[model samples]
Every structure is written in C-alpha cells, then in structure tokens.
Target: MRIYEKVHLVVATPGRILDLIEKGVAKVNNCRVVCLDEADKLLGHDFKGMLDRLISNLPERRQILLYSATFPLTVEYFMKRHMKTPYEVNLMDELTLKGITQYYAFVQERQKVHCLNTLFTKLQINQSIIFCNSTQRVELLAKKITELGYSCYYIHAKMAQTHRNRVFHDFRAGLCRNLVCSDLFTRGIDIQAVNMAETYLHRIGRSGRFGHLGIAINLITYDDRFLLHRIEGELGTEIKPIPKVRIPNLCIRCRNNSIMSWTRWSLKASCIPDKRSLQLRLLI
Candidate 1:
C-alpha cells in the first residue's frame, strides 16, 4: 500500500501497534481497512492477547484482510470471531514453487558445516543464508565459516535490534556473501536472488520466497528424518532425500591428542571417543 502511495499506511508489530492505537499514532475508530500478514504467527499464543486487545478496540465497521502462508486451527478461530461473511481464499491447494529445487542430504550435525562448505564450493553460490535453530550454533558456524575463508556474519533474536538491522543491511548490500541466522530471518526479511539456502528442519521455512529461483539444501540426519517427514506431511509435498556423501577427514589442531574415533551420522563426520557423548551433544 505504501508503494502504491496509499493514504495513511501504519505498519508495526502487534504489541507496538496496539500501543500506537492507544497513543494515537493510528486511530482504530477511523481505520477503514486492516491487513494482517502472517496472521497465523501473529495470532499465536504470544500475540493472541495483543490481537484480542486490538480487535476489541477496533471500530465495528471496517474491512479486515488476514493473510498467512500457513493456516492452522487457531487462525481459523480468530477469523471466525473477527470477520463477518469473510471470503475464504485457500491458496494452499494451489501454492507451488516452480523455480526452487529442494534437496535433502542425510548428514551428522558435526559435518553440517563441512557439507555446507563443500556445497558452497561446488555451486559457487553468490549469496546465501545458513539457518540454525539456536544463537550459539549460529555464532559457532559463522566463526568456523569465516575461519575457512568465507565472508560470513550471523544474527539472532538475542542481539540488540540495532545490531540485527546493521547485519541485515550489510547482507542485503552484498557486503557479506553468507549469513548464519536463527528463525528470525525465515519470515519477513527479503533478500533478492538468494542462490542457496543451507538449513536444518526448523529453518527449511526460509527458502524459495515469492517465486524466486533458489535451492534449499537441507543437511539432515537419521534422527532428523522423523521431523522432516512431519514437515513434508504438513506441506503436502515430498522432500526427496539426497544421497549422502562421506566427508573427508581434516587434521585436528587440539593439543590433547586422545585418539579420536570417527563416526558418520547425517552427512557429517565427528571424531568422538564415545557414542554417549555424541548422543548427549545431539540432544543439546
């Protein structure tokens, strides 16, 4: 709407939007139209109360449009409660990504970085985002990738808002070729021509945005197959498992040379003295 030079476009987070309405940044009484993008996420437990408050304050006569990529039962309830004779647009049946290639590689957690490095070298992807489930892993992967001579940066929800903005800005400007991030980058953030996306099950939601030509390469493990299956079931699509390739061993620089025995789990190789420790690490 702002791009079309529409009158009075106020975009904000659900909580802040409510605050603004109360403080007069926007007038709910005067609002002729209300649009909620990613309505399912916005209507989740975290923002449900805020949504309720906002809806309670909204004027009786107003058009509300709720848009979501994925709609579960909660979103449906919210719509039935707030919308009068709402038009149901079920795009899930028609939704398709023609330009994106989805491939899964069964590799271990430790070898994910190595597999990613191999893929990056093989594809020579100009720009990419590596999504991790946690901030600590993002930081560790970014550091390792940088040490391996790749220009990489990482951002997570725990970081200051200003820092996240700067990191995103730099990434968009092509100052960095690779980004390691949590689910924060999976939804709203848009970067053009992302040639590649390397992620796990949780982060698979980030790729193939807006019909762009992209490749989503997931490094999965035997343990991750169940989660991947659940995602495929939810999406009503087949996530093809790619043939796993053995990662060549690299010399360790650790001072303690306690003979490290190697094991392969997804496509990653780890040198561990015991399997119990590896299982514990994976659980963590």
Candidate 2:
C-alpha cells in the first residue's frame, strides 16, 4: 500500500527490496539517490548477487553513496564497476579511536569465561557491549554472563528484525547494563553510556563515542595471536597487556592535562581504590 502510494523514501534490506521489485510492489527506477550504509558488508559474498540485481533495477542516472569505516579490495572493485568517478572523503589516518584505552589479556580457550568474569569484577563498567564473532557464541556467552549474575541480553543477525530493534532500543534506553551481540551491532550504533566494550578492532570502536572516555578489553586465546598481531598492524595501534590493578573512570582529557582536579591514572602504575566507574565522572 505504501509502495503503491509512491512513497519517496524506502529503507530495506537488499534481498527484501529485490523481492518487492520483482513482485512489482516497490519501484526504485525513479529513486534519485541510493545510499548504501555498511557497504563493505553489503557487497560481500552473501549479499553481493542480490545487491547487484537490486542495483540493476535502479535508474542508471541515480546518485549512489557508499559509506563504511573500511573498504576491502572487493568493495573497491565493486565501486569501480558500479560508479563512475566517485568522489571519496577519507577522514581517518588511523583505524583506532583516540579516547579508547585498548588492552589485551592472553588466556586459554577454556579459561575465556574465567577471564571475562575477572574483567567484570575488576573493571568499573557503566554499560558494556560484548561482541562475539559468531551467533552461537553470542548466545552462549550471554547465557554464561547471566549465570554469573550479570544482567545480559544477546542479539544476532539471525533474530527477527523486530526483536533485534527491541533489544537495541532497550539497551540504548538503559533497561539493561550489558549486551552481547554478533558483529551486526558493531556498525554505526552509538550508545553514549557504554564505557566498557569487548571485541576486535571494529567492535572496539563501539565505546568512546565522539571523544568520550572508554575502555576496550580483548580476551585473546592462543589461537588468536596471529589475528591480534594483524589487527595491531592494520590499526597501527598497540594493545597493551592489562595491568593487575583496576582502573576507575578514565578521563582522556585529564591525562592530557585538561583538568587539574582529575587525577591521572597510569596503566603502568598500580591503582588506588576509587569510587568512579568507567561511565561518567565529575571532575571536582
């Protein structure tokens, strides 16, 4: 009905939109602008064929925009084939965000749960998002976190979109303190109160929004050593080994001599007991 009403704007997944196009329900032939957010993933193996088919249905003269943090060779190739003389604005020289403190702990595969438990106990987290590489791991880790007595909710790409939206909204609204999700949640979603985050390179960016203080702790098993090195190399940032002491609220500005009252905490130095968690602190 909405399509028949000639709605000017339409947002949908490639597969669904393609189906609609084939069914003669949605018309993108007159779409003036086509924007693909997360273009890297959209152009990847899974959706590439559907996305190509969908684009084929669009008017050739339409403006197309591709946005993503990183563009792999495949995405670049796709852009070359689809776009003519596309102008790009690259804002990043380094991959990692400035306000995030990155730390890594080496643990055995079986000890990952224990390491996570240790992080939960030692770190001062206001709200946290933990990323698991797989959907199965996301569910399993969320269950383990719940069993450990921490409030947790999990989301994966396989879940219904409505259910995913509900979980995302509830988490953003502070209905829960912790969320476990697959890589689907790592892209472009901003939660200001999330001071603690766990995952790989892209996932770490979930914390420290717009120059705010945040911490990223990576629990790495032996199998992940090569991946860690590669990530460090690609990002051009070192992930220091976590210190034994617990750190309270970190003020990036404080460390950079922005405030006199906010005590500077060093990663190398032993920490004193403090009340401030990683969330927010009023420097007094």
Candidate 3:
C-alpha cells in the first residue's frame, strides 16, 4: 500500500474521478502535478460541483495545468481561481501552416450532399471526414453517401462506446475512407492521411492538423453566417468566400419569375421620378 502512493493514476471521466475520491480509491491531498485535459469541457457548469469538490481536497501548493484547444469563459474563471500566477501560452498565432487551403461556399442546406458529391468527384479526395452538427444528421448523411456508391462510416455520441471504438479503429486502418461524424471526433481522433474535410460552422478545426497539406471545404448557409463570423473573430482569421461560378439553370422548378419580377419592377420605379407609378406599384 505504501509503494502504491508513488504510482501515477489516471481517471478518464469526471463522474469516475468523483466516485474514486469518495470511495477513497484516489487521494488528491498529496498530488503535486494535476493535469486537467479538455479543461474547457471539464469546467462546464455540469461538472462545476464535481470540480469544486475535487479542488477542495487537493493540496494548495500543487501545480495545476489546464489544457484545452478552445478555452471558454468558465474554464478561464477556473484557472483564475485555482492557478497561482500561471503564465498563459497562446500558440495559435504562431502555429502557421502553409499546407492547408481553406475555402468556404455559401450553399443551401438542401444542396449540401450534392455539392459534396460534386467536390469529391472533382477533387478525388481519397480520405476525408464530413462533420455535421448533430448525430441524426451524421447518420442520415452517411447513409445517403453510402447509397451513392461511396464507402462511408459514421460516429456520434449516441453510439455505444464499443461501437465508436470499432468505427475509429476501422477509420485508422483505412478500411473506411470517408468518415461522417459530429463534434465527437474533432479533438482527439488522429487520422494522419486525411486529404480533405467538409463541415459546417465550428467543426472546421478537425482538418489541416500537424501542418499536413489538407483542404477544408466549409458548406455554409446564410443562417450559419453569424456563427462563421464568431469563429473567425475567435481565430483572428477570416475565411474568404469562394466565388460562385454561374451555372445554367435547367430545372423547371426554378423558372418561377415572381420574385425577380417584383425586384426588377421595384428597382425601376424607385429610380423613376413618377410618384404615381410608384404609388400604384405599392398599392398592387
């Protein structure tokens, strides 16, 4: 029992950590180096009570290391309260990568899959991950892509841990070339040969890792512009919009000219000095 005190311990989950602490399986009183990985997630309000309980039991003079890819306000507060005059290291600005070419396209939600398919055919991306915002969408999109004669696998938080492990193993072994997932794979999953990535909003961070030459294609809609703007502000980098090439309209459904007619008439009357014509147009 005395020799066990010198061994390093690891507890993966907050609940498990608290349970160990309560059961006297782990002792925090003598801990000299405490590392909180994914500190932003660990410092969420959902884990606040557990963290407080853990901190209350730790030695006051111990060093606390908080590591996170994205720091939230709650995590910052936790550092201030717990850490003693720690120096901040921000490497994001210095971490430059020349290999990745990031591009964004303003696409409608309905056209996302079609646009992805077009990109796959044009670019011939051998390995990629398509990130979606939700688990249901991940499954739906994976099914759709697989049905289209592409091999795709999906992972999400809703899946059992064993299933997720199997999917990740298959992905790493190159048994599956395309992976469709939610934010679950954004941080820790390491697939070194990913040639391209497609995602919406905040999940774009999954690509271009370790200075590898990668292409990140963001399929954004007008509704996601605000989110994109916020992410740009956080990263201190603007994602330039891709210039859309005009495509010939072939669909009968797109032939409705009511909206265009209204716009053209409104603009013409607005430029004209005929107040009566404008009034008539407004009345109509």
Candidate 4:
C-alpha cells in the first residue's frame, strides 16, 4: 500500500484544514471551483483573516460559489473584498421564501415542548428537525419526546464522535420521524445572533430538499420575540403566527406517508395542480 494517498476532495474543521494548507500538504492551487457551503457563517469578520489567506493562495481565476440561507451585510462586505462580480440567488422575497413556508409560533417556555409535540401529531412533515440552543436542552427534549411515544432522536456536540455518526445516518435513512438538535448542529462555523437569521434558514433548508415541499417552524419564547422580529424584518418574509392547538392522537408517520401518497397520486392525474393548490389542500 502507498504510504501517501492522492486525494481529490478533503473536508475538515477550519484549524485542521488551515494546518494542512500551511504545511503544503493540502494543495488547491489547481482547484477549478472553491465552494463555501456555509458562506454567510464563515466569511464574516470572524473568519475574514483565515478566509482571505486561503483565497489568496488559491487559483486567481477559480470560480467561487457561496451558499448561505440568509444574505447579510457582512456577507456583502466579504464579497466586495474577495469575490468579483459574483452572482447571487435570493431564496426569500417580500412575501415568501422561493417555496419554503416559515412560521414563528410564540409558545411560552412552559408550553414550548408540548407545542412541538402537538405539531408532530398535526402536521404531515416528511423530515423535520427541531432546534434548541443548548446540548442539555437537546437531551431533555429528546427524553420528553420519547416519553410522549414519539419516534425521535437527537444530535449534539457532546455525543461521542462515533455515536454522532450513527445518529446522522439514522436520520438520513428516515429511521426517525424527528431530529432534535441544538444550534451546535453547525459547529466550527460561527452562527451567532448577528448571522442567526441565516442559520435558521440554513437548518430549515435541510428539509424540503430536491424541490420537494418543506416547512420551517421556529418555537421561540417571549424573550426571543425581539430576535424573531429582527430576523423577519431582515428577510422581508412573514413568519405567520400559528395559534396553539391541542395535541392530537394521530400516528405521525402514518399521516405523513398517507399525505405523500396522495400528493404523488395527484401529481400523476391528468390535470396537475399548481404548488399553491397542493399547499392549500394538505397544509403540508
């Protein structure tokens, strides 16, 4: 076996990746396209120095593609400094996201978990992820959900690396209906309040992939009302405040599956319905 293997793609944390680059062990001078998956989170002031150094070392004419959920002021500044005539694609407009529906439900801290549970029972969500702000909350929420007999799992930075891998795969395989996690879900890439609007958009973008219908629901308490309004104003999209409803006894998986089946059936019909029709019909 060769002691050194040739690599075409490399993924690692910032510090480690920077270490490799500094040592000339990870070469990207010939790279045709340099993509930053979480651009808004990474290109801000926090990573400006590292990012500028890395970009300075890359091919001068390489294509730079940045993907971020929310476009922010810092991101614009970063583009001005590093990117030339870069094109942009905005997912949000004055009225709505390109396709995603966002709801900012004001659930009091005491009823927050219950409200989440009620949503699971009511909505026909295919793949949903619930975000909390801390690891301890992730654990506590997961436990409470299981007690309610919901098929749910959680991932946080505190878990063993191996175990975290298993949980991620389980989620991708659709083994669980819900994934409860903390904002640490996007670790190493700083996602602070300044860029949290983008962070929320990024997380919700996880679901509703491949042009399928998706929903993003944020459960915030009174304290977070200011933050929620800030995000809404910045995005220029409405997060409809949904009234709290009683928890239903429906089987979430069965409801989700049935709804999906019906959607497929409808799509195959001679008169195909528009997106608005489907959304209104199923409230998916």
Q: How far does residue 78 in candidate 3 sit from its true spot (Å)?
A: 3.5
Which candidate has the highest lDDT of all?
2
On residues 32-87, what C-alpha lDDT tens digit does candidate 2 reach at each position? 68889878778877796887788889888978899887766667788877899999
Report lDDT (CA) for all predictions. 0.63, 0.70, 0.62, 0.60
**lDDT for predicted candidate 1 compared with the true structure:** 0.63
72-94 in candidate 4: lDDT tens per residue? 77777778987888887875332
Worst 10 residues of 3 by lDDT: 275-284
Distance from true location, Cα of 105 in model 2, Å: 2.3
Which candidate order results from sorting by TM-score in descending order?
Answer: 2, 3, 1, 4
Could you give the C-alpha RMSD of every candidate to the true structure, in order shown? 12.2, 6.6, 14.3, 10.0
User: Of the candidates numbered 1 and 2, which has the greater TM-score value?
Assistant: 2
> How many clashes (backbone N, Cα, C below 3 Å) per candidate?
8, 0, 0, 0
Q: TM-score for all predictions?
A: 0.58, 0.66, 0.62, 0.58
Task: Name every residue pair that clashes in candidate 2.
Answer: none
